[model samples]
Target: MSAAITDGAVKALISQLGYSSLYPPQEMAVKSGILEYERILVTTPTASGKTLIAMMAILKAVEKGMKAVYLTPLRALASEKYDDLKILEKLDLGGSKIRVTVATTDYDSSGNELAGADVIVLTNEKMDTLFRHNAEWLGNVGIFVSDEVHLIGDRERGPTLEMMLTKIRRNYPQSQVVALSATVANSDEIADWLGCKLVESDWRPTKLVEGVYEYGAVKMSDGSKFKVESSGVSSAVDLAIDSFNGGGQALIFAETRKRAASLAAKAVDGVYKRLDKAARELAAGASADILARGDDSELTKTLAQLVAKGVAFHHKGIIKILTATPTLAAGVNLPARRVVIASILRYDSDYGGSVPISVLEYKQLCGRAGRPKYDAFGEAVIVSERGVNAEELYDHYVLGSPEPLRSQLSNDSAIRFHLLSAIATMPGMKKPEIHDLFAGTLFARQYRSATV
Candidate 1:
């Protein structure tokens, strides 16, 4: 009900950004005292102003003459946050200017340089490495903003985030933590672990419609079926073509990099046929620019040709185009009118089998459907046939919530690495104290309960 922000510069910036009113999630976050140095975990839908909440807290920290650090899981995301936050550097913070720095890349920054920074953005690994090197400036940090906190569920990078958070919580007990997360099913558990209040919501700025595509028709989650004119073509191509014809961009998530490229190449004919002359020229120029970067390989050319036709596939392999890997989903800003999940199962060599991705992961993919300001509604389509069924996908992905956050600290290698780093960084930290630090981790909490 009340304006949670009281700082003059922050209020002016928010007004300049044209936020006359806060959305439900942002309002809850503010009312929860996130702006008052309370450790808070915000789990909400994308584009719901989580970044704004973090910024308000960061500004609050800077106003108190203390430094803040924004930690992201990916370098690209750190760069994106840096670009957005670097503008604050120009603001006269009551006669003194804020100095924002991005430390995502592998660079050696001295302690004095870091101490002079008002705000610093760094990736999880970069921050962990900084800790290993004992960045003395960390002692003066008053707040830490962690973006994409749900990545704690990831096996590879999850441990890094957990370790970093644990280290920050244990070592920097006086510093406040503002964690930003996607809407996960077990947000309360994560909140409990961090001793922060959970401000969760499913709010979205645009309406999202979920459906399953089969036989040239989409069976929406609401039980409404709409026939897509295939004109003898397959249903998948028809769905994509229809979206483009409706003047909206489409993003397709395939099972593999090869499938993504092949599907993009296949859709080119349909996409090109529907585009007008002006649109075609613009797509061609985009495609030419991609090719000019010059890999000349079949895959690159294949993707370039698709981009030329206003149809493109995204994955880790293809660069310069939109990507939707979990890492990219958090960082990349590409918005599509429709998102088609070509396959739910991705082959994981570690498991030596095809594994279905979690509903949370798929939900993140679906969240990409509508651009905030451009589209009235976004469509998320799941391609169903053969091995994967339509009804099952609808029940699992559409109806199901995200998976709970599980700690990755159980991995011996991860614990060993972090233990060594903690010991090396903390002066004269004894064995029993180190054990206490690990005992306070989410993994310890989960394991202790699982045994009970």
Candidate 2:
């Protein structure tokens, strides 16, 4: 049966993905010339079906017979999104007709240029490495999706991402670029760089109620509020957890990795408080063997039960979420109903993680707040101590828009070294031809915002 439908281009895309309905943002994004293989930047809330928009654009490009690259910042997010897309592919009418591949940056999966695959899901670094090694194959690259384009504003990772965008354009000059961001202040400057179109909106499906908790009270823009205990700063976290009991996930922003871990461990006090005389007596007498192990597996099982009732943590020690690549959180499928971030915005480590967080890192953590498929609504929040103001965090970092995107030096030895190899292998192709590739990017979008 031919799956061709005349009146419903969107219906076709949604049908292909097994999605029943398209959110307004999703529909608006697709209607914005994604079929033209034009570069676009979509600024929407987390869990607002941004992935669907990216996949929709890629599907159109695939139908036109082209290659597309999907890039994300976290190994966890990359893997998670890749899994979601793969599931959608299984339902694709043209599923078997399209070739799709996924790999991390360190993995050497680009040996054949991914020429056989219509869509390649990988991290930003992996795609950069592929383009650096071979520009010839990328001539077929129609769309380059930069999932967290705001990362280009990151002081550390942003530098690399910035350079990678430059290198990609330097390689596939006409390729359409899709820059997706959740929290950026200056998205238009980035749109102007590649000259395409901009779809910028701060609209979130779930209403986020920002609140500030100090000393003993939790106050929101709305009148409903609560109180934190007076354990100095720890009391603030306790109150946030209490907020979760009523409704809304509390993403506590801690200051250090240790602080994050501390907050995670401490949030379980409610559980501990429940294990009083009767509960403790039952546990002590009910299952000594299960209790003897005293390991994470045991604790996780216990915590999982608590979570089933409605509670959990999102941080490093209890979950190894900070730096581990492939454990469980490698792609961020955190199930916590409330998130507590012990603000690591500024580093305090012996190895010196002393630099203030770049815009990318800030949003990355904040983005974890809302999980669309799971909740009626969720909250993305920030917490600060050391006399640091919550409003200040929101004004400068959390609530502020994303920073503008910029180009890093593309001819850096690593990038140039690889493109040179493709040049040697391609017979006749100048770097300028590659530079022309960016003609379809957000770098060139004229409809960008004037706010920043």
Candidate 3:
């Protein structure tokens, strides 16, 4: 109930989206002038109404006859956001219909087809490619939104995203920037880099109960303990079955794809027996759909069988249980009532050994729990394998804060690639211009120097 939400267009948009009132984070965003085109950075837990805040700003931009560009770190995320924004197309604000477009492929073209789009969604790499191609439509974008903006700390893709934001800030100083992120440790530094009003909160619509699974019981952070019936398979499988018995879905994060498939295979019987007639029918349909894809490989057949039993791994379809690798943590908005981490360790090629995941990654996995409007509460459990201390798991992942985000733009290859792109995009750009452009990056801000 802020002044911004009182506007007719805003009210209509909210009602159209079937929301009776803004969540606390959304209200905080509005109070910070998000609808007024203020550059705002929102760092909150998942399912906390971050998308609604971006939608409000997009609506405001469309109202002024200016376009909005929504950027994501992954193509799957881009498609998800595009589908979410498609709802806005039904609204006619000031006699203007919002048109949404997604551009994640075909990097060679200038994206002229997107000129008429009111809202354009693109992955970070795709946006960088569009900038290189000098897409004319980009000039009309009044608002730039970066979903999963916390990926700025990532090693591989961080430099591109960091550079993209820096370029946007430098080239479009008047445009509004709305950065939506998961709860990260160094949110203030990122907000300062973008000159955005930092709105940080831990508020979630559904309560999140984090726990560590050891032996055959779960000890939650809230001082609660529950015994999980032994499935004779694994602790993670037991946790998933417990969730299904309570009329809830579960997402299990495995260390590898093979392990994910193995875990799904093990949980099939438990999950299948719990489904009712209607649920079984739906699962059968999903299984058939998977088989109909024409892959016909042994892996595909195994997956189809798992799907029929209301379980699957790495494959997308309707199922009560899904086991996947950590890649699913950041991509799409697939929530579950319970999230079971099968293993917190993954083999790293760089180190040639298993390494424990960061608290940020753990938070991302746990954030998948608790779907809004569906579950009253969510549970996240980390399974402690033999030789791994349960107390360490509890202290590091369940009770720890995420690490601070640092820039990955200082590397030679990243610098070279971005510098070359800058030179190619702006012909005859001298040293000072290049320096100025990079000076806007988080690397320069954090290091207190742009020495290149």
Top model number, lDDT? 3
Give the residue spans of candidate 1 off by over 4 A. Answer: 107-113, 231-237, 288-304, 315-326, 449-452
Residue-level lDDT tens digits of model 1 in 1-452: 23666668777667756788778898898889887899999988777788888988898898898999999988778888998898787678778989999887664554455677899998898888888777888988999999988888888888889988988998899998999976567888888888888898888888889998877778887678887887564455667777877877777777766666666666767767777788778877777877888687987787677777677766322222232334456645566788777777877878999899898788888877887888888888988867677788888988887888888878888878877778877879987788787887888888983331
Question: Which candidate comes out best when scored by TM-score?
Answer: 3
lDDT of 2 by residue, 155-204 (tens): 34554576567666665677888878776666666776646488877666
Q: What lDDT, from 0 to 1, does candidate 1 have?
A: 0.79
Task: Rank all candidate structures by their lDDT, best first, as comma-separated numbers.
Answer: 3, 1, 2
Native-to-model Cα distance after best TM-score fit, residue 143 in candidate 1, in Å: 1.5
lDDT against the true structure, per candidate, is 0.79, 0.56, 0.90
**Clashes per candidate (backbone, < 3 Å):** 0, 43, 0
Residue 353 lDDT in candidate 2: 62
Candidate 3 lDDT? 0.90
For all predicted structures, in order, the TM-scores are 0.90, 0.71, 0.96
Among all windows of 10 consecutive residues in model 2, the one with the lowest summed lDDT is 320-329
Q: What is the total number of backbone clashes in candidate 2?
A: 43
Report the candidate with higher lDDT, 1 versus 2: 1
